[model samples]
Target: MPSVTIHTTQNVSIDCETARIGTRIGAWLIDAVVLLVAYLVVLYTAEQFGSGFNREVALRLGPIFWAVLYFFVSEWLGSGRTVGKRLLHLRVIRLDGEELTPADHLTRALFLLPDVLFTAGTLALLFITTGGRSQRLGDIVARTVVIQDDPAADLSLADVLTIRNREQHRARYPAVQRLAEADMLTVQECLLRYRRYRNAAHREAVQLAGARLAGLLGIDPEEAAADAEQFLETLLLDYIVLTR
Candidate 1:
């Protein structure tokens, strides 16, 4: 139940569950197995071309070289995913939920030596459990965190306008085409607020939304304000029907 609340640039705070240490270690193990397979293939292919002792050394060193290159390029170009992270539904992202650039990926991958390799991830485990935001040394240095990507629920404009007088509402405000998609979404949220709470804030939101939408569609603001909740519902229905 450990979570980190991230404050985005747009001033929205989102609470996200931190990826558990076990999950992260599992992902790393999966990637390591894949890399091991790839390394064996490379060594077997090279062994066919060289002599005994020299071939033995090439088999040892060549895969390490390829693994380093592979990790760097995959992490960078794959946008902070290796095959394992993708399968585990884990992604590396900035603290603000923004996408990481190649430089950010490179920085984290390069710090793997101290954070993961020499210490068998002892340092990473210490940092993540104690660093407050589930950060490993690489994540701390790169301003990133590994998050489990949970799917969000979807809502449609039509879905928000469900009411008894939907047909009548649609008929009353046929000019809903004047509202853009974003405006329609705002209206949908306002209608939901009005329906759920009917508090001062919710009522005020509906009133404001109804007035603005009425203005956009060339309706009288006085009429819109008088019956703001009904007006907003009608506008939402009109938008849903007209847009479809």
Candidate 2:
């Protein structure tokens, strides 16, 4: 199976599986069921309170309006998680790893009209099955992707380091803030290997990576080689803070 690796603001590289088409359909069904239940309850209430409006019209239109409202509000407030997504351990996030804004959620919900409601989900199905990133039309437009939050294996000791000391890192190596996200991911992987393996090959690889990064940032080679782990950690922290 394919996976999408997201570099978090905390300097953690998480490999989240792209949700498959079948899994996305399952999530949609679960949400549909929830909407059905809500529709029944709301329709019942409206039948009693909506004196001037036609009950049949209310019954027909109320659910659609409520469903749209629910999806929009819930996705935004829940940080791209609906009840179905929460149940299935699925989440929507930006391809660049930033959190979704209210506009992003609204765009996604509004596009559901074309992607799911009108086309019977065929458009969404086609896009997700072929898109490779598990993107629907809305996701593509909103720069978002859905990921399955499955438990990860092969964690390294470097993964244990908390990258919250951004100020300290920036104070030490301000130039590291110029590193790109891809470059930061590379540094992260090397640090993880350095922490996980006690072998000479791993140490040498880390040393080489540290030297190259030091040159890129114009840091003194001797200083970077003296404490490669600390240099890499500080670089990762600077990248995370600046990018975030």
Candidate 3:
């Protein structure tokens, strides 16, 4: 599939790069759960106190309470993170990557009225299915997009992790580090095009590419093949992110 990155018209800056839709959805679910908890807490607190608590205090104070909750708890403590976002490793921020102000928080929260009024989730569905950017009613109203907090995440890696690139790979794979760009290209290029090949094509190509890559890096072809591109890239990238 093709990917598009949203760029700012203001100063020639990229806003948000296209990331896997899954992580974005995952973050949204996390946020929804937090909102649910907040909703439940309000309801429960009212139950404990009185019918006055439920019907009067909560009904009257709910808006202000949640608004402030979003501002201070979600924004300040979580840095624009709701409960869902914290669990999913995601956060919301202004388009410019600045901390969202109280006004921004209030503005976004105000947009939730449509969802509440309908109670049918129409607004949310529209946002989830929206093209290019995952702009929900609130996000569009606020001019924001939902993205994976971990921009570097890739599906091929089972765990949340970070991988390095070519220059750094040399230091990590010092023996193969001496290999010229052409040699690296020879393997990577062939491997990169494996999808164009059929049947056992991916496997066969991987074996051959691994052999060549191994030769340059002075590693065993079998071992190199088993390592997979992800491991190699991880070794290249110095930083690793391990998530439970």
Candidate 4:
């Protein structure tokens, strides 16, 4: 699988696997089936009502309007996931590691006309295959790519909740309150990297980060140096306990 590395503002690097072409096509087909069913249901309901205006609107502007609205609203509210994407464990993410904005959602939605609807997915497949990041025309225009979601790759709030029974655990570091959520995320990423590779470079990174955090929190350097990994682990638990 092809992957892209995104660097957060805190300089934490995250590698995300791009969705396979077959997977993308499968997701698109699922979405298309859903939209087709929805469109037919609405058209049938409008016809049964026997309102000329409703019927006219359904005939003239139903499919396009509904599709655009569906894509926009689903991605916006679901955090860059449509029904198909959610089902397939796929998510759209920005290259710059920032949250998607309204403009990004709207741009992708509008560009779907040329990328999928008008071109019948031909152009989309071309771009996705050759773009080196599995981005279609809409994704390129919106500065986004579809990535396979890997739950274990990230430290989610759910994972934090499972860390040593939050209610019963006492925080060891009171100064953890001084760090922002992003800093904690960086710490978590550093820990994850070290755990994944278990190489000297990653171990060194964890040690350096632990020392830096200890200095920032006014802990003695010798204490952090004693067992930098344990020190960082305690800080992670402390941040979760104190903040949440």
Candidate 5:
């Protein structure tokens, strides 16, 4: 699968796998099935209302409005996931390693008409397959990419065991709560990359992430500089202990 390495301002480089065409197709099909079922339900409910102006509006315009609303609201509230995306563990994220704004979602949603609906997905498929980053028209316009998440890769049995022990442990950094979920995910990715590669770049990623996080958490410079790796690990543990 194609992957992109996003370098954060903190200097942590995280590799994210692009969603495969097959997986994207599956998600689209699932979303289509959901829309079909919803349309059917709407049609059935409309029949109960009998022939009238309201019925005409409901039959003619309701589905269009609902479909638009569904995509917009789902991505916005679900943090870049629709029903299909959530089930498939695919999320839309900015290429710049920043959180996606509402404008980004709106741009993608607007472009979907030409990218998928009007062209019957031909344009999207073409761009995704031919483009280096597997981005469609909407993705290109919005500067976003669809990334696949591997839960097993992110958290191993050992990590889970450690988390279980953290339930009763006091947090070392209460300020870790100031960070968002995305920040913690980046920290986790940096740690994983360093563990797997153990090269200069990956090691720098860990060190940079640790220093950045320590600064963010208001940790003493001497303490954080003493052991960057340990500081990052402790922050991760503190996050789990405080949040979950």
Candidate 6:
């Protein structure tokens, strides 16, 4: 799974994954079309009373109404669907892992004015955001992120199983997590060519791991290093118990 990361003000990376970009953008585009049509209707209504097409009214009301409706109902009822997302399957979530509330809706809606005021000015910033997230002025101010509606978003038994199988030896040892992420060679190479290690560096790693494991287990590190079968037996035992 790809990890989601958000950069802090100081540029520290945080681990998190929001919704998918495809779902969010697809939903937004569908909603934009609907909003545009609705804006024309509102303008047509104003014009029927002899007030003319009311360009100013349409310009102001279009984005405002869409923002308000989307922030409030879409986020609250269906979690940022806005009819389009409900059809296409998407969601908008907060950046801080909180539910979107009424206040969040109103605040983010109000913050959108600067983003849609003109074509090439401040509103142009909507195009430059990273990760395909077009937050606009409001999204930046609200610190909210729109994520996808992935059905399988949690850890499953299979994930745990894979980790267990790949790390059986380390389960009783408590060093699997670190070893899993190491910049070392693959397990295949270590197994097949371990006896032929002529390089000092290769020999060093095997010796160090054995020594470390022995010291941790209160055994003779030299003895563990001398007999590879004992180490393999212990590792296999760990795997068997973990699976059972």
Best by TM-score, which number? Answer: 4
Candidate No. with top lDDT? 4
lDDT of 3 by residue, 85-122 (tens): 65666556555434456777666666656643344557
Report the Cα lDDT for residue 44, model 2. Answer: 77
Span of ten consecutive residues with least summed lDDT in model 2? 151-160
When sorted by TM-score, best at the front, the candidate numbers are 4, 2, 5, 1, 3, 6
lDDT values for all models: 0.69, 0.74, 0.51, 0.80, 0.76, 0.50
- TM-score of every model versus the real structure: 0.58, 0.65, 0.46, 0.67, 0.63, 0.43
Query: Candidate 6 lDDT, tens digit per residue, 15-112?
Result: 43354546555665787787778766766776787554666766766667665665466556765456786676455555654456777766655654
RMSD of each: 11.0, 7.0, 8.5, 7.2, 9.2, 13.1
The residue-by-residue lDDT of candidate 2 on 66-158, one tens digit each, is 767788888888767788887886778777665678889888998887898889899998888888787999999998888775423133222
Cα lDDT over the full model 5: 0.76
lDDT at position 25, candidate 3: 59
Q: How accurate is candidate 3 locally (lDDT)?
A: 0.51
Q: Which runs in model 4 stand beyond 4 Å of their true positions? A: 54-57, 152-244
How well does model 1 score by local distance difference test?
0.69
- Stretches of model 3 off by over 4 angstroms after superposition: 1-15, 18-29, 36-73, 115-119, 151-244
Off by over 4 Å in 2: 5-15, 151-239, 242-244
Q: Which prediction has more favorable lDDT, 2 or 6?
A: 2
Model 3 lDDT-worst window of ten:
155-164
Output the better candidate (1/5) by lDDT. Answer: 5
lDDT, residue 147, model 2 = 77
User: What's the residue-level lDDT of 1 in candidate 1?
Assistant: 52
